[model samples]
Target: MFLADAGVPTVSWNLLADLQEMWAYPFMVNAFRAGAIVSVVCAVVGWFMVLRRQTFAGHTLSVAAFPGASLAILLGVSTSLGYFGFCVAAALLIAALGRKGRDAGAEESAVTGTVQAFALASGYLFISLYKGLLEGPTALLFGSFLGITTGQVTLLAIVGAVLLAVLALIGRPLLFATVDPEVAAGRGVPVRLLSTVFLVLLGAATAEASQITGTLLVFALMVIPAATAQQLTARPGRSLALAVLIGFASCWLGLIAAYYQPYPLGFFVTTIAFTGYVLAHLGRAVHDALGRSRPRGRTPLSIGGAA
Candidate 1:
């Protein structure tokens, strides 16, 4: 069975030779290009999402991508269309329906959870409605690199660039709003508009990530690397850069591993990210235990947050 599932005929002794062989194919080249774009975009957006404590909303958007792709398969259209369209629409709905005020977080969670449940049901329904076997989009549920094209790579690059530019334009205020919304509002920041805009951007990022990591495992890129980086460093810039590095490494290594073996790509990606997170957590714990010579300023878990 191991032999049956191998993508390459044999393991090679030479690392550079194996890498050269992996990159020799146009499909592999496109996969790398797309993965690079997705990794950077998702990493940046995910860092802010984590800081804002909006991971539940991000998870909902990722889940929403599934039904979108499912409907596209039923309509015989591009799955990318379904992925983008549904995620954004669901985000708008969540933003609109979720209550505002002191209880906003609790209300938003309820709305996000409801949308996630409905999205899952709709995806299954779309799958069941297809008369023939749903082969194309189904392969993407667990992630695959098959049929990635230069055009798709170009599209991903354009989307990634746009996301980064928009984020740059609003990074400072968004950070203020995220860490202390009340104070940000008192300082004349448009907290509500920023929240809505961030949610939409998050949905777009989630959709983009789904193309590489798939609908079910999109959080592997969207959350794990950012969370791991936050665990290691509290500084926003360092954490953001570290998240991108972690995400990029995981994406490239997972692609290489999947190229050598025929196992599902999402499994490799998620496992690598998860392992990094575990290691970071352990290191943080050890550092906390060994330091007691002088009193150092504590890094707050979050604003007014306890361990």
Candidate 2:
């Protein structure tokens, strides 16, 4: 009884009804659950990464996951094991090679770039060697929300909780070290130890996010939200909270859009995150310009007194 019906509902399209329909499926529920954990963890760690200028290091760790996953597939093992193992190893290597001292920036960049190059090559090599009709190549690069299991969701939750707890424990000293490493070290803060711990946490976060966004697009979750939040605020606490909220909104909206559309989930997520970042930048620019345009002082009162 619907005109030109193409499986359209007879009742008016309602937002609540649409949400209820989306939540009716078990897979969607699992997807949302996993996504929530991933978003929170990535946002928190990513805020630190941004503050410390560690985006390149984070990207290298993410690239490391590709080789890990591909090697896991080649060895017929659980991909999660490979993801965590290789990423952690790569993090250690980077931390060791890039010690905290003068010229540390150059050393870190060189080491991270080398690791990323080798990781990419290794991933492709594994792919080429993978016989027996390997599938989900696209899923490994981009991601899919359809096949997320309850076990995977539980694993994500446990890992995310541990990471959050660790971050909370070290949050104060870590912030001090990040803001002024030399001063913090002089004041008895173990800057080197904190650096090592942070890198390891970043690696774990990259691996965890790769499960949902794949290795290539992991930055979509980590970098974009944090960068957008930083653009909007200078206060550390507010920026961190904003980043988490932005990540959560992006993930949920991306999931819903992917559910109704024919594209990959990663595409929607990355696009939405990128859009938020762009908007934030624009808003900041406008705010700055307006502030500049406004006069500063009591010039009118001086003129009236003179008159």
Candidate 3:
């Protein structure tokens, strides 16, 4: 009945009316606002993470947010506090343990894996210790947009703004360091400090995104869009813009789908994001194949004929 009234098209189509209906509900409005902010922040931060090959570290920080949220519930505090605290601590810890330079890839992975393991275990422990309802556990893992408050939306916007501002300030130097650490270091770029700062920023972004997509599905918001953009473009600025655009589209579409369907927002968001990524890869593969098949330079006989 509501869907019909919203002009969602059972047998007929009404795009403007459908959009107006979706925007009519306050909760949906808040959801869209929150989703937009989360998408942009995650896209920007995830772009740099992909460039630096720090997906593992991003995953670890996201996982660590689970323990933080659970612990916050146990202590009866705001879950956001827990998310930020745990993620930032984990980021600093990872930075401290993996400071042996970029060449120490194995060591960094080991450190990240260890942190992820402990964080998961600790999250379960917190869950076990909680005597209240188990619903919070599910929400922490899968996420919900139905009951999102205006305050939460405002908070998301604030955090997104700050993260973007910081990224703008250090984006160039960080890109330089990520591309060639040895050369960047030789040029006095404060490679280690920038790395540490970037990790902390990643943690912050992970924590913020977890609030929307949940800890388990953080990659949906952070990784997929950025990876898709990278697959589609080699230019950094264009890639970043494309990543943000993809993220925004995924979030909006996912929210609309979740509004009509009885499913977790994270599931919809992740599926949409994954679909975009797959399409990007397919397009790239087709383009590469076509390029290879096209003959480059004229053959000797053709050149002689032309002469």
Each candidate: RMSD: 6.3, 3.7, 2.9
Query: Model 3: what TM-score?
Result: 0.93
Better of 1 and 3 by TM-score: 3
Question: What lDDT would each prediction earn against the true structure?
Answer: 0.89, 0.90, 0.90
Kindly report which residue pairs in candidate 1 clash with one another.
Answer: none
TM-score per candidate = 0.92, 0.93, 0.93
Model 3 lDDT per residue over 1-307, tens place: 3444665433128877888877888988998999999999999999999999999999999999999999999999888889999999999999899847545789889999999999999999999999884688878988878767898788778878998999899999999998988999899999889988999999999998898889999999899999999999999999999999999999999988887776788999999999999999899999999999978898878989999
lDDT of 2 by residue, 136-247 (tens): 5777888778878899898889989999999999999999999999999999999999999999999999999998988889999999999999999999999999999999
Model 2, 295: alpha-carbon shift in Å? 1.0
Q: Which consecutive 10 residues in model 2 have the weakest lDDT in total?
A: 1-10
Global local distance difference test of model 3: 0.90
Best by TM-score: 2
Residue 253 miss distance in model 2 (angstroms): 0.5
Model 2: colliding residue pairs: none
RMSD, candidate 2, Å: 3.7
